[model samples]
Target: MIAIVDCNSFYVSCERLFKPHLNGKPVGVMSNNDGCVIALSNELKALGVKMGTPAHYLKEQVARGEITLFSSNYELYGDISTRVQAVLEEFSAGIDPYSIDECWVNFDGFAPGQLEDHARELRRQVKQYTGIPVSIGVAPTRTLAKVANRASKKIEGFGGVCVLYPDSPQTKGLLQRFELGDVWGVGRRLAEKLGNMGINTAWDLRNQNAKEIRRRFSVTLERTVLELQETPAIEMIGMDFARERIMTSRSFGRLTNDKGEIREAIRQHAQRSAEKLRKQGSLCRAVLVFLRTNPHRQDLAQHNPSMIIELNNPTDDSREIVAAAIQVLERLHAPNKRYMNGGVMLMDICERGTEQLSLLGTQQSDAERQRSEKLMGVMDELNQKMGRGTVRIGTPSAGAAWHLRCAHRSPRYTTRWEEIPPVRL
Candidate 1:
């Protein structure tokens, strides 16, 4: 059987972890630049504060004490997520951390009664450790477990854990009630198409001939539906220990006709990407730089250019990544054009130990790599403990013209003292 463990109101719940007074209040977390709502509490949802609703539109709600808004506190949320995952790991033999607030666990070889008890224990442990509530759903298939999870949300007596065994009456009822769109892999477009064919419910889709579904739809859809009909075909492997590519991108607060500001933005992006590479104990063999004018603004002259630079050797050294990034920047930059966004993407990444040295040119000396690694380690440690960007490259300074305009951003209350949120008694 597969079990899905999902956190309730994750971002808002993270805030409530330390501030228990917000238990029954309407609260939400804003997206980047404090532009819109990304996470909302149950109270906030009931008040019609829809997800992705711009904060500006909710000003009246804020004034009326109808909603409390918070900036995205990634540090606090990440730490809490780690704690919750740790608690879950203690019980389940295998776990797939699907997202920040959701995970899938393998529960095979366990009896039906044992599965129910284990699910309840998982909820209790996670709540006790992280002060956040979670819901667990168990079924023969991952898709059916997801349906059981939805049903659990409606039944308060379930205590946040629901099991949908294959032969159970509740499981059959759930399949009949759930819409096709509500299934795991079906999106709006596919759901509408399926509904046209009268495949409105989960059971209906499951009962359809697998080969007919493949020929009518696509191979991917057919496979997904087939998996949902029985036990989950996918298996959870061990954790992802290897690092991948590192990237840094952002839209500027204002359109920049000046080339100097564009260069500054690219430099800052390169520096940020380099920092991320070092954090993951990885190095880059290629760097990609790109810039674009605001496509939405028809008034501005259009210019979109991107260039990739291959390195002579893979290196975690910030200087090397910065140099390669600048090479691409020079190639992509256009004259007499206003650029609205610029970014650096570090690719062809590999672990520090596995990186291949330049065959022709003398490789970066051991002392040089060691010095850079030490500096990056110190910077990472400081940032991890004190908060991100507390000590960062001066290129992204407050006075930079390319800085994002985040006037409505809430203070980093848990990370920085000066920017801490003010609490009212």
Candidate 2:
């Protein structure tokens, strides 16, 4: 059996964690740059405040005090996610962290009949330890686990836990009632196609000919059909691990055409990517930089260009990566173009110890590599102690025009000492 756990309204819940008074109120969490709603509480949803609604469009409602808003505090959310995952780790050894707010646990060791009880216990512990509410679903396959999870939350009286056993009457009834689009991995396009064939419910899709579905659509759809029939089709593969290439990018707080600020942003991105690479014990053989103007700003001359620099040797050293990234940025940047955002991508990654160096003059020497590693290690330690950016290759220019707009961010209650909740005298 497998169980999937998902946090309920994670960002909004995290905000409510430190501010209990906000519970039961309509609240929405904004994405970066305070642009749009990324998460909303139950109350907010009932008020018809649709997800992805732009902040500027809600000015009247906000001014009328009808809805409360918050900027995305990723640091706080990330720390809370870590705590929740740690509590879950105590439950099972076969854990696959599906996302920041979701995890799948293989319950092979637990008895089939006891799965529901174990899920309840998990919910209770997670709430007690992290103050985040979660819904759990248990089934014979991961796809059904996802379906059960939604049912647990949506079905009245389910009490935040649902289980669908193989060859069960209850499972069949639920599948017949649930919509096909709600099934895992079924998007709008597939749903439309399925609907054209009179397959509007999960049970209809499950009952379709599996090989016919594969031939008509894709092997993935066939796998989904099999899983819905209570046959496991997917296995957890490298859960919570780095991808082949790592990229970090963001829109600027405001539009700017300045080259220096653009370089700084690219450098910061390259530095962050290198840190991630080292953390994953990998090295990159290429660095790419790209920048673009805000498409919405039609008044400005727009330009978007990207360039890649391939290294003779792979390395995780930030200095090396930043140098190559800057060269690409220079090539990509054009004068008179109003740039809005830029970022760095590290590709062609390989395990650190497996790097093959060219037997030529350009290869980094052993002494140089050791020196670079030591420097980055110390920098990382200092930043971890004093907070990020305490030690950077070149500090992001103060009051840079491209700084993110986070006007309503909450205190870093969990990660920073000064931001910790104060006690009454």
Candidate 3:
């Protein structure tokens, strides 16, 4: 059997972990720059606060103090996510971390009759250890596990865990009740196409000829249909085989046309991206830098420019990546233009050892490679032991002008020592 465990209202739950007073209240989390709503608690959903609503539109709620808002605190979230994953490691041997708040567990050795009991215990232990509520779904295929997860919340008597078997009679009604658009792989366009064919549910899609569906749509859709019928063709791949792309960007607290400020932002982004590359043991051959003026400000002259630079040899060194970003920014940067945001992207990634050395003499020597690797490893270890930014590239000096404006951000309760919660006697 395959099982998927997903955290419930993850961002809101994260905030509630630090502030217990916010529980059972209408709470929402905003995106970068506090622009739009990205997460909504059940209470907020009940209050009709829709996801993606502009922050300015919620001024009335803010004034009334009916809704609690938080700026995205990624440092706290990432740390808590790591803790949650560690707790999950005790459950099953075959674990695939699907996302920050979700994972798949394969129950190869466990008895089938005790699966539900095991899932219930799993949920109890996670909440006991991490203070995060999770819902689990168990089924024969990964797709059905997702379905069972959704049903766990909506169906009565599930108690945070739902199991569905391919041969069970209940599976048919549940599949028919679920909308086609809600299926795992079906998108709006595909939903509309399927709707025209009078196939509007999982059961409808399952009844269609798999070969015909493949001919009409593609093999991917055919696989979805087969998966619905309880055939396990979709298996999780290992991390080594996974493709990855890392991008770090943020909107400024205030728009500035200063070249130095823009340079500082891109440099910070490059340094952070390089850190992630080294953690994954990957190297990138291309770096992309983008700069843009705020489109909402009508009085300002809008300029959005981006540039991509390809390196002769792939590297995970922060210095080389920052240099490449600055070179591109020099070409893309404009004078007297108020830039609202800028970012750096590391692309064309490959495993560090898998990268073939160029025969044309662009590759570094063995000694140089060893020194670079040692320097990066030490830097990463220091940052991990201390807090982030404890040791960073030298481009960002004291009191940098490009800091983010997080007026309502919560404390880094999990990551920082100074911000840890106080216990009352």
**What C-alpha RMSD separates each model from the true structure?**
3.6, 2.0, 2.3
Candidate with the greatest TM-score versus the true structure: 2
Candidate 2 residue lDDT tens string, 1-425: 88999999999999999889999999999999999999999999999889999989888888998888999999999889989988998877567888889988778888878888988998999999999999999999999999999999999778999988888898998899989889999999999999999999999999999999999999999999999988889887655466789998998888887889988998898989998888888999999889989888898888888888998678888888999999888788887888888888999999878888767644457778888889988988887778777787787887786788998999999888889999899
- State the C-alpha lDDT per candidate: 0.80, 0.89, 0.87
- RMSD (CA, Å), candidate 1 to true, equals 3.6
What range of 10 consecutive residues in model 1 has the weakest lDDT sum?
234-243
Better of 1 and 2 by TM-score: 2
lDDT per residue as tens, model 3, 161-184: 998865987778789899998888
Model 3, residue 233: what's the lDDT? 65
The local distance difference test score of model 1 is 0.80
Clashing pairs in 1: none
Reference-based TM-score of each model = 0.84, 0.94, 0.93
Off by over 4 Å in 1: 108-110, 236-246, 253-268, 275-283, 330-339, 349-357, 361-395, 399-425
Q: How many steric clashes does model 1 contain?
A: 0
